[model samples]
Target: MKFFTGFLLSMVFLALASCDSGDDAGVPDKGYRYFPLAVGHYQIYDIVEITYTLRDPDTARYELRVETPDSFLNADGDSTYVVYRSKRLPGEVAWTYLDTWSARRTPEELVVQEENIPYVKLRFPPYNGQVWNGNAYNTGERDDYQLDSLGQGQTRGAQHFDDCLTVLQHDNEDFIVFLDQRKEVYAADIGLVYKETTQLSYCTQPGCLAQQLVEQGVIYKQWLKEYGKAE
Candidate 1:
């Protein structure tokens, strides 16, 4: 009888231990820090855009600054922050207003609207290989954005980030005809650190068909040059 009582106690202790392990393993990591947003926060990026056409390719270099200086409550009672975008030439001292956008964050996801098109930037508790439609809230065609990697280190130009993640927005290429690839990387506290987009159409002419000559489209790259909070 004593042996039986001791065995039962051992089983209970094992069950408790198992439950504790499960609780620890199931803790969710709400990765909201990767896209942190707040009033007075701003980021500056160096932009390089290359446009391809039947004529000579044109390249342009500029600096872009995005600032969040105000917020308002949307119809749904959720607070949405206003994003002000401005640009200046490489050596220019004055900035030209480009446009205004908006961004909202909830417990579940982050959404940003640009040119009246809303895009689901990232889903909460992001996990590697997770996929979702970036245009879920907009009228645009469906675009599957995937979190290709998470909690990884990334370096861009002279910047180094310890905790970062890469989102693969689109990647469809046919060297003979066309290419479309877009990706964005976000650091833990700095938001978007790097973005690259390439949309090109190859010439299908008999002579250039095999050469993979880019006939048209643009290649855009933006790298974070600095970030800070406005007074």
Candidate 2:
């Protein structure tokens, strides 16, 4: 009888120890993850890629961002694009964005649309051209890039692109850093002002498509409650 009681007590102690060990192992390994921009929810998009060339005539500085399918000239004169964004929060950067590590990777060649990625679409005031595989003027190209540092532990993702504002110049005549203007919105009826240095728009081609709908009095305007400012 004494031996049996001792055996039972030992088993009970072992079981309790195993339960504690399991709990310690199950405290989820905390870390960041990457999700496409579409999964992010914000009233207004942080960046915008438009289909026009913004020129500073006074400073003789001009920046051209090709944002439509018409911008790329293929062997058959075709174009495609999509938006690859850096983060989901309006102004905050995420840890899982493709940045320094991606830039170090091998170059990627442009290809046709495939399953897996989401594309931004525009309806009203529609473009008189083909659909894009991703965002902006020229079709996707194989190149090298890094995420420009966003402040306070936020980092922009790296990308393959034609050009990004990698260098900062002191003179306003020398640079145009397209920035996200709104960190938060105060009121619905109030108007705002945006200086020349800062601008707000969607980041990728697909995001631009959504914005295009907003510009054209489409579904986005009725749904997303974000707005613009005075510049």
Candidate 3:
């Protein structure tokens, strides 16, 4: 009887130890994994863009697929990723290559350029209310980007993400006002799960005294459809 009781106690202790180990190996603490950039990491997102004009508002919806094909040496002799992006409008049979962009991720920030304009997409160790100059490299205009909030739970498609992030970029000039807002959600073991971007350009007419709606605005939303990692 004593031998059986000892065996039972040993089993219970082993079970408890296993449980603790499993918990430790589970999800990690809120680390700097908000954006997972790796070679061969690919993500497909459904994009919807809307543009406002004086005559009529135009809505153009499409699908944007991005994949990190390979890395190349930059001027600083560091490996920079070359992201290949493609776009396909709804009802289109084939996808068209949009452009090849370069991205570099350092311990501080993820720097990317779109249409020859460099911008800091994200900063490390994301925290609420953190502000940065997104348009630091832009000569035309400067924009202020801030982490509006964190831990915003969001669901996209069949997957659900918790503790998502929301960032906002806005700028105001003497006559023209621009705002480009974004909400991005990341998932463990995967890169960007969901993202949404809204851009607005408002200005007043020259003759009119008050601010007139010259342009309605534009909104772009993207969701993860499927992903395949390159080995």
Candidate 4:
């Protein structure tokens, strides 16, 4: 599933690259953004984490309800959503459904757009003079550079914009995600500006989150702890 999605996007991105009209970062947020209102019952309110119950906007209940998964690339690449329920209670359910109006965007769309992409790549801030490409990010390569700063790499970030970095991470099974990260350059060593980390959380099970069977019928999630540095 993931490979198909990426493959389709790569072709689309390749074609779109021909008409690169510079940056279109602050366009989406320019229009009216939607916020979930508690329908008519604006009087009552109880904020819970997205991973929690799906509340009902009308009845103000939170019981026996269907829920929509609100995932995002914040630390992990997933879905994002707005809870909708005409009524609520402990047992009320949230009626979750598929949302259309999809997008074919690069990671740079986070700041340019208005999505909540966490800025975790800023561990290494820029030092002296240079242009910081806050999109050319890498994985686990935090030590050699500077702690949190956009650490320097062997490659030049001159062309690492939008989702261009994905070209470097293409078809790799070990790589689960790639987010547009903020970057800057020091005297010689480059520093990080900010990165909207696209975290991929999954379980190693037959039908678990992003599970796949590498051998036989046994399914598994390709994951590893980020405790070491990137070689």
Report the number of the highest-lDDT candidate: 1
Report the lDDT tens digits of candidate 3 across residue range 1-231: 999999999999999888778644665554356666678988878877788876677877788889898897778766678889999888887879999887777767778777667788777777888888887767856567888777677788776777576666653332355655666666555657777766666765576424645476777777888887878
Would you list the clashing residue pairs of candidate 3?
none
What TM-score against the true fold does each predicted structure earn? 0.86, 0.20, 0.71, 0.16
| Count of clashes in candidate 1 | 0
Candidate lDDT values, in order: 0.93, 0.25, 0.73, 0.26
Arrange candidates by TM-score, highest first: which order?
A: 1, 3, 2, 4
Which 10 successive residues of model 3 have the least lDDT summed? 171-180
Lowest lDDT sum, 10 consecutive residues, model 1, at 20-29
Error of 1 at 216 (Å): 0.9
Model 2: worst 10 consecutive residues (lDDT sum) = 99-108
Q: What is the lDDT of candidate 1?
A: 0.93
lDDT of candidate 1 over 1-231, digit per residue (tens):
999999999999999888778544767679988988899999999999999999999999999999999999889878899999999997799999999999999888899999888999999989999999999998889999999999999889789999999999999966778888999999998899999999999989888896879889999999999999998
Model 2 C-alpha lDDT per residue in residues 1-231, reported as the tens digit of each score:
999999999999999888778543755421101110111222222233233223321222221111111123346543333322222434334423321111000012223232342222211111223233233223444222222211112112221212111111111221122322212111112111111122323223554443322121101101112332212
